[model samples]
Target: MRPKVFVSQPIPEPALDMLREVAEVTVFPRLDRNMSEDEWIMAAQRADYLFVMGGNIITTNVIKANPKLKGIAMVHRRLPVNNSIDLDTAKALGVPVVFQYPWEPVYDRIAEATCDLTIAMILDLAYRLIDADRYTRSGRTLQEHTMALMGPGVTGKIAGLLGLGKVALKMVPRLRALRMSVLYTKRTRLAPAQERELGVEWADQSDILRRSDFVCLEYDYNPSTHKMIGEREFALMKPTAYFINTARGRIVDEPALVRALQNRTIAGAGLDVFWHEPPGSPEMAPSEEFFKMDNVILAPHNGGATWDARTELTKATARQIVTLIGGGRPEGLVLD
Candidate 1:
């Protein structure tokens, strides 16, 4: 008998077809919205493998219901599997859960998006591009807008990366292309060859915070890194610096960020993630004070929502599932 696979939410057709080739695949009937926890458990109980997507909560009860489940795979980037899955229970049950890491082509798309947002935030905040466009649309001339809005240029500036991971590595060339100096800080320093190749100099966190014209957060969020940029870190930043976070929101203290902007401690910010998300959810407000700031540019955490990235992520998830079913160790296996 072929091994059974259950997909808790809809995925790309290509991945579904791939699973079908190796296993007996069962998917939740609805593609428009996610199934309830009870529904997910019901479907999961019958399978040997469970492939989950965002919005499905896989609790201990759900895990226990599926006695035959050998593995679980989360098919999205940045959505940590531990967030939804009961990792401790899975570990006790001897079931391995896997996630997608930002690597190679995966990092490429996300890095490109992050770089674009970083530049855009700097330019938008400094030049007041949105306001200028508004003035122009209201029948103002270039001279009036230029004179009123004296924006800063990006060339010959300093940029800081919080982590020297794949995304930061990919950003090196782009930052250099604009004639900017790059400083990075992480727990472990990169090899000398990597430093020379990427043309980045290692700096202490405080130094990067103090000297950079643009400070971008690209690190992973965990216990130690939670609220890593709080009042003290924000105080260390150049008052003229523009802050950008395409990473998780919990990494920065939201209250501190708001205060920084309000008191002009930092020039401006471009935020793609927030302390609370999916704007307008009961968890938080969609139009918070940040939305009121002309200096802040906000996106709905869509930095990596491109079609190509989504397709590739699904394909990667499919590969991992196949590997696990074959009794091979798949990449990105989350250990408890």
Candidate 2:
């Protein structure tokens, strides 16, 4: 008899088929709703392994729900991230947890898809695409270029990236293609040789904020990043600049951002993440003000959400579960 596995969320068909070959797969039906803690524990009790994705609460209690649980598998951001998995407990129970490593054929493609969304957001704001769409739909036409929807164009502009990690690194070339100069900042600056190689310049956070025509956040959300961008930070931006955040929302103080947009402290904002995201679908975004602002372009926290990308990511994550259940160690960054 094949082992039983419970999947916390619906993954792409290829991944589900892959898992089905290894085990009897039980997938949660809803892609737009998260499982409660009780629901997670119940699922754990019935399965030999659990495959979970974003928003699933896999606490220590859930891990221990069934001592026979083989392992846990999921796709997440880079290694050593603050995620929902209970690593310590999983280790204590002798169940292994898996995460992807950058070099494992997942980073570049994932980075590309994500950077594509980031650039799309930047372009949308720079050209006022959404506003133009609404205007035309509202029976408004270009009468005489009376500044109805004029915006700062991207050519020869400056794009300042908050973090120069994988996604941002891939973004550098894309921004360059649009004839934009790139400035980047991180806790530990990159080597000068790497800077020259990547055709980027290292800049202080203040300088990036003060001089950039577009400010973008490209890292993860953690305690150190909690509310990193605030009222004072918004004041540092050029009023003609646009702000783009495909990173997590809590990194920026949403109210401060709202104030900035409300007062035109910055020319506009393109947001894929929100400070407060409800479970399941992004239908219940906490920031209502963004929905009303024409200067803002919003997305459902789905930067890495292309059909092919989702299938590949889910399939890659499922591969780890299959490897572990087959008595082979997962190739990913193994935690205990």
Candidate 3:
């Protein structure tokens, strides 16, 4: 009999087809909502293998109940710990848990796509393109010397980066090409030579918020960084400056951010993530206040939603699952 494989969340159809060739596959029905704990437990009782994704927590309880599980495969660029997978329990039970390489093509594709979205957000805010589009679409015509759509120019402006991770590194050239000076802040300061080569100046968090024309959050979110951008941080920014976030939503205090936008603490904002937007959760409801504001721009966490990126991620993850199912170790992947 073919082994039964349960996918905890929706993935690209192509990956599903690949798994179907070797196993009887079951995918959680809700594409816009997260898989419930009850569903996960019930599936574990019957599935011979499990495929996990996103911020789903594969707890010790889930693993302990699924003794028949041959292997569990996960897809992510970060450490499995970030996903809350119980590595120790899985190891104790001798159920190999697999993840793609940190430098795998799946992550490269996501980083590139996210970089594209980040630049697009910057451009849209710098030129107020979306606001202009809305006015035009609402049956308003452009008039002579009305000055209704004038926005801060991108050239010669300062762009502050909150994190200097892979995506932020990729964004350096794009910002430079627009003639914008770059400033970055992270836990570890880059070497002076690397700074000179990248044309970025190191700055403290406070300085970045105070001096930058565009403050972009590209950092990771952990307990220490939770709600890092708050009322005081917004107050430090120039009243004419803009805020952009492509990072996790919890990184910024949602209420504080909303208050800032309403009070005009900052000139405008471009946001692609929001509070309560966990992985594989399509039912995340964004703030209605953002929709009412003309100065704010929003996306549905679509930075890494490009077809190429998603396809590569699912395909790579599928390959890992296929190998483990066949009792063969996957190349360029970590199995524990």
Candidate 4:
């Protein structure tokens, strides 16, 4: 008999088909949307392999119940803390966990690209080039503007990355080419050699806020990091700075950000994630917050949802699960 696998969330059709071929796929139809805590554990108990996406909680009790379960496969690009499978508990249960973050490195590339794009927008470079296209017709002179940046993470690294990991590693040379000075701050200390290797230097966080022409939030969201940028942090920024947040939104207090944008604390903000997913009522499914304000750019968290990108990730995740169940160590395992 084929091994039984429980799918705790909806995945792309291709991935689901692949799983069906390898295992007797038992999908809880209700779970195709989101699974409740009780339902999550029930699903866990029935399957030999579990395929998890964002919402399900794989607690210790579930692990203990699923004596036959061998491993877990988490398919995602960014494995936020809230969504991470409890690694310590999984280890205690002796169930190996595999992570398929095929787009992990791609996030840095997007960050770097967006950073460059934001800077160009701030400098009016792209605007000017467009203007130049109709220069003869419009008779308007091209202009450049200055910007101040805030925060030092993936987006901040676009101005120049501080090299937190491999994703940050790729942004250094591009930043130099654009004549953008990379200023950043980190919670940890690094030797001069390490700094030179990544081609970035440490600066006070506030200093970046005060001096950057464009500000980017690139840090993760956690209790310690919640509202790392509040009224005080926004107050430190130059009024001309165009704040950008492709990072988690909770990092900045939403009310404070709205106030800043309304009062013109910084020129404007571009946000990819918000404090609340689905923003308001669940009845308004597939909801977004574009009606809230003009200065803010509220995207539906599609920063990396390109078809080729997500499909590749789905396939990679399915393959990883198959590999681990076959007793081979696939790349990107979350549990050490």
Consecutive 10-residue window with the lowest summed lDDT within model 1 = 278-287
Better of 1 and 3 by lDDT: 3
Clashes of each: 0, 1, 0, 11
Q: Each candidate: what lDDT?
A: 0.78, 0.83, 0.85, 0.62
Please give, for residues 1-336, the per-residue lDDT of candidate 2 as tens digits: 999989888778999999999899998898666788888889999999888776565788899899998888767653455447778788788888777533446656667788999999888888888877877788754565758888888999999999988899889999999999999999999999999888888998889999999999986767888999999989999999989998788889999999999999998998888876633232336578887787888877777687787787888888888888889887774644
* Candidate 1 lDDT, 102-220, residue by residue in tens: 34666576566666666666667766788777777876445733577666667888989998776677678888987889999999998989889888999999999999988989898
RMSD (Å) of each candidate, 1 decimal: 5.1, 3.3, 3.3, 7.9
Q: What is the lDDT of residue 291 in candidate 2?
A: 72
Candidate 4 TM-score, true structure as reference: 0.62
Candidate 2 weakest lDDT stretch, 10 residues = 277-286
Candidates sorted by TM-score, descending order? 2, 3, 1, 4
Please give, for residues 1-336, the per-residue lDDT of candidate 4 as tens digits. Answer: 888888775556787787777788876665224565677788888888888765455666777777777988876543454334567788877888877555555344455554444444334421333334445455655454422222222333235222243323444465556556666676775688987875666777787787775666767556888878889988988886667666566777877887888888876666666766421212122213335554455544445455555555666778877787677887877645
Which residues of candidate 4, in runs, are more than 4 Å off? 8-21, 26-34, 38-42, 60-67, 76-83, 87-96, 100-203, 220-226, 275-291, 300-302, 327-336
Model 3: what TM-score? Answer: 0.84
| Top-TM-score structure, candidate number | 2
By lDDT, rank the candidates, best first.
Answer: 3, 2, 1, 4
Q: Lowest lDDT 10-mer window, candidate 3?
A: 76-85
Candidate 2: give the clashing pairs.
32-280
